[model samples]
Target chain A: MTSAAQLTQAQDRFIAVWGQMAGAWGVSRTMAEVHALLYITGEPLCTDDVMERLQISRGNASMSLRALLDWAIIERAHKRGDRKEYFHAEQDVWTLFRAIVRQRITREVDPLLASLYEIRDMTAIDRKRARSDNEDLRERIDIHNQRLESMLEFFQTLEQLAAMFISPAGKGLQAAATLLSKSPREEAAP
Target chain B: MTSAAQLTQAQDRFIAVWGQMAGAWGVSRTMAEVHALLYITGEPLCTDDVMERLQISRGNASMSLRALLDWAIIERAHKRGDRKEYFHAEQDVWTLFRAIVRQRITREVDPLLASLYEIRDMTAIDRKRARSDNEDLRERIDIHNQRLESMLEFFQTLEQLAAMFISPAGKGLQAAATLLSKSPREEAAP
Candidate 1:
């Protein structure tokens, strides 16, 4: 097969894989496909270009582009003489992953962490009340508190790790990855 | 409110939050609720126990329990003189996370990696043919290869990190977490 045809096939395959991943991750498949097109082509694409290339509706292309922009994974661009706006993906892999991590932490993790803290505090009041009179209730509350604390600690650790990873000046992710890949005690001694 | 009432409310809230997390992570909410119930209670519970506590249908409870077992996050138990099978979650935080990471790697990451390798190999042949004839097409193929390579590398790094974390004898995750929590240069110097 011709190189052009082969390249097209490979691009389509990559887009399909990315779209599947988006579906699994609960994002719009069309939106992921649109991003894939822009990223793979490594060029600015207008909404019409997206629509024609992906065979998606104009509205779908526009909406996908808008959402991608909101995620900060894609940006608006303009050619010197062109009136139509164009979009391009943030092609750097680390930046793209960091953007996704930041967005998810904001959208999902932050609120969950808040709720966890609130629940623990609310339950702490009950524990205090139980402490005065009810031994059985106090024990149960203690167990519950322990469970909640462990979960809270795990999530907090994850949040801290994510923060380190996405920090602009930090190479924490690579450093941590390298550290983890080594034998724990052996690496420590060196 | 009474301590019992407050404790129940807290448990319910915990389960609800876990259920919401499940929905976002593309898992069944009921399944996560069942797991949460077992996990928070820190006890082996039968299907009837799960159903009554979660107010879910027996079928839903049973199905969720089975899936949890399949994921190896929960295991079956039997009480002497009691015929009913009970389920309990892996209570240790690290073990629980390791089980989930292992399951996801098998079901999601492994398949995706296989596809990536196949795509790369298929395009390598086209790249070789393009080398002789088409400069423009060859350049495009090279760009595509580079993109594919970066994605593959990122995923591979993640897989390696996960493997290290889940290794039974490895303190890799905690060690790495501690290492990352410290400034990289300071940690290295020490």
Candidate 2:
């Protein structure tokens, strides 16, 4: 059992650190802190552990964990002696990053693709003429949407490959340049 | 300068996509769409375009622009012909991503270092005793902080080099793994 003082101190420290992190990355403070808690728990923890450690509600824990699961950061784990389901972070940050990249592609890029197809298939010329204004709008969207989707698909695959550390070396990084997201130059600089 | 129809289309398309995009990523709908607009606009735009296209308030446009500027996705532009400081995206999406990654490293990772140092310098016996729970917590935080800092520093440099795309394909991505972010997967995944 940890002291109330010590636990609160740790929670405060995490909350402070995570606030800056949340704003920077677009994640919320509570979400980042909750993720940070599970990330550092050092073992798979149940809903109770999350609630106790972070002092959040069970419903909130479920929501945030589901969110993280969507990000693919935390995954399910069942300890040897325990029946309750637990969750832990993928410690290899790259692997964790890969899961997120992949999930984001599926959730973000795929839906964009669906939206593009739907708009592109709009064939009523009378409607198009009547809404040429809207048609013009849709056309530009189709153009840019295709571009982003093409780029994002490539990026997601490379991230998966990178997590595997496969196809090796500069190939993964070069993937960044020709079709990948982010610059190879930036990767090399730091 | 774009036509009213063209701008409307661009604005509508982006606003719709941004909402979906924001949900997948941690960013807000307005923030994502704002970035999207900046990405495709051939020339720099001012707050007016942002408001006109999205039908947002002047204050809302200003606030969102400030947020994007903070995120490093959008920048204030000063063209030779124009006195009004227009805003523009970095254009290269990958380059933009690199800048965001770097900024996040500075905001999120750098501050943690300061906190750990302060925790280390804690003078209270309660704070200093290694066996004490507080000290144990502090020490754990320190180690995590160090690992994160080192990782962020390494990746930040790697991203810089990768951004340049200077490394020739023959030896580039191959060289990036050791020279870039080192994934801990020692054994090649079979």
Candidate 3:
């Protein structure tokens, strides 16, 4: 096959893999495919380019591009004297990863933490109202409180870790990468 | 409301929140609800208990329980003179998190990494076979290779981090927690 054909084949495989794996990561397949197309080609692509290449509906391509913009992984690029608005993906992998994490945290983690806190506070009011003579009820409340606290603590830690990774200073991701790359013994050594 | 009634309400809310959040984390709603029910109640429950509490069909309950067991977050329990099998969730939050990461890595990350490797290998063969006179094709292939390598490196780093977190020596998780909890300045001090 020609080199151009080989290149197209590789790009197709990359897009296919990305689309397939997206569901496992809680992302839409089409959205990932759109992003993969932009990233793999390393070129500014308009809605027409996206629709034509992916064979997706115009509305679907537009929505995916809009969502990718909201996620901050892709941005609008302009060409002089051109009427069409083109989109470009953040080519730096670290930036892309951080942007995705930041988006997920905002969309998913924040609401989860809020719900956990709401539950805890709601239950706290109930815990205080229990009759003193009801030992069984009190014990059950304690257990419930403990379970909620455990979950809250775990999620809170995760939130902190995410914040560190995506902080503006940006040393956290590199530090974490270095630390995690070390063996157990190496990491453990003082 | 009575303390028992309040407890039930709390459990119900917890289950709902977990079920809703499960989709964001790529888990089934019913499966998360089943796990939440077992976990919040802190009791070894039979299939009957799960079915009645979740108001799900027997098949759904059985499937969710089986999946929870497969994820290693829940396990079978036996009671004296009881013919029915009971299931229990891992109560410790850290253990639960580790188990989940391990399961996701096996199911999602492992396959993703394999696909990436396959793509890289396949493209490498194509690159070698490309005609030397075609500079444009060579450059395109080079760009494709670079993109794949960057992604591979980032994911490989993530895999190592996950491995550290789930390693049996058990220091990795705690150490990472401590490291992440530190301010950037404090972490950089040593």
Candidate 4:
């Protein structure tokens, strides 16, 4: 039988790896560690439990839990006849990924897209003004405007693609896999 | 014509926004700012230019530039009869994204997949050891192993999809858009 020590070791390793993965993706290590603990335990754990298991401070545990809650990847749970609030992670990896992706699109991509549109509009107006001033400056603005337009198109397309992937009937990953399995190279050979 | 002051203001705003976006994605603000500067200028810039324009220390600029170069989104260039090394961004947004994605897949996803596989194997061995000694321990290990397998499958599928998208003739973005536009719901309806 696997000893209790072995079990603890395995859990610790998993949490550490998960924490590193989250760090690479721009998430706080503590937040990722908290989620990893909950996920590996497959049970609701209180902040005290998290603190004990991860060797983190009370405030750190509390903040990590709150951040996870904000990300919608973890939830507060009430144990039967227990006063301490516990937490559990959304076990489905795909759903968790979708939530993160959705949040990033709204928080980061949307703002960038809006800014790009504004910049493009402003540059276009400036381009018009520069046309009759100096040929060199006008040409420079023209190139810049073209690049901005291309960049805007790229982001717009990317946003549309992300939305489609996250749609209910998307099955995007599955569909892409199927398409890839069909061998595009042979079709393109002609 | 738009005055130089206005142009500088717009560039500064764009760089600031770009830095924030990069931070969300786990890149340093300075690295993103440097790339943004080069991207906007559409021209190569030396270390001094980047330092002066961004108001960053020489060491900070050098480090950020080196990091960007490592990511392959920027390249070092030399001016004729000049010893100073200038850097330029990829300029093409699609190409820039491809470079970033490629680097991430190599540096992050590949290592993660390897570790998950190792963890799964270790858990499986432990599950076997527990089966004859303790039923409860075995069951718990089994559940953990199952979760690990599911997680592994999820990552494998993601890696496969990433590979296909990055393959030659993939036209990944356009292809995804086309697939999404076809209305999978209607196709699935009886």
Query: What DockQ results do all the predictions give, each relative to the true complex?
Result: 0.55, 0.14, 0.62, 0.45
Fnat of each candidate? 0.55, 0.07, 0.61, 0.34
lDDT of 1 at A98: 86
| Candidate 2 local lDDT, residue B129 | 37
Worst 10 residues of 3 chain B by lDDT: B181-190
Interface RMSD (Å) of model 4? 2.8
Worst ten-residue run, lDDT, model 4 chain A?
A: A176-185
Off by over 4 Å in 2: A1-28, A66-72, A75-86, A113-190, B1-11, B22-28, B44-46, B66-90, B112-190
**Which candidate number would show the highest DockQ if scored against the true structure?**
3
Alpha carbon lDDT of residue A139, candidate 1? 86
Please report, as a value between 0 and 1, the fraction of native contacts recovered by candidate 1.
Answer: 0.55
lDDT string for model 1 (B47-154, tens) is: 999999989898898889999999999999999999999988898887888888888888778888988898798688777787665688888888888888888877
Off by over 4 Å in 3: A175-190, B128-133, B175-190
Candidates 3 and 4: which is better by DockQ?
3
Collision count of model 4: 0
Q: How far in Å is the alpha carbon of B165 misplaced in model 2?
A: 7.8
In the range B1-190, model 4's lDDT, one tens digit per residue, is: 3545556666777788888888665688899999999998788999999999999999999999999999989999999999999999898777787777778888888998899888776666675466475787777776677777777877777776677666664476556555554463575777
Off by over 4 Å in 1: A24-26, A131-134, A175-190, B131-134, B175-190
Q: What is the lDDT of residue B2 in candidate 4?
A: 50
Which numbered prediction scores highest in lDDT against the true structure?
A: 3
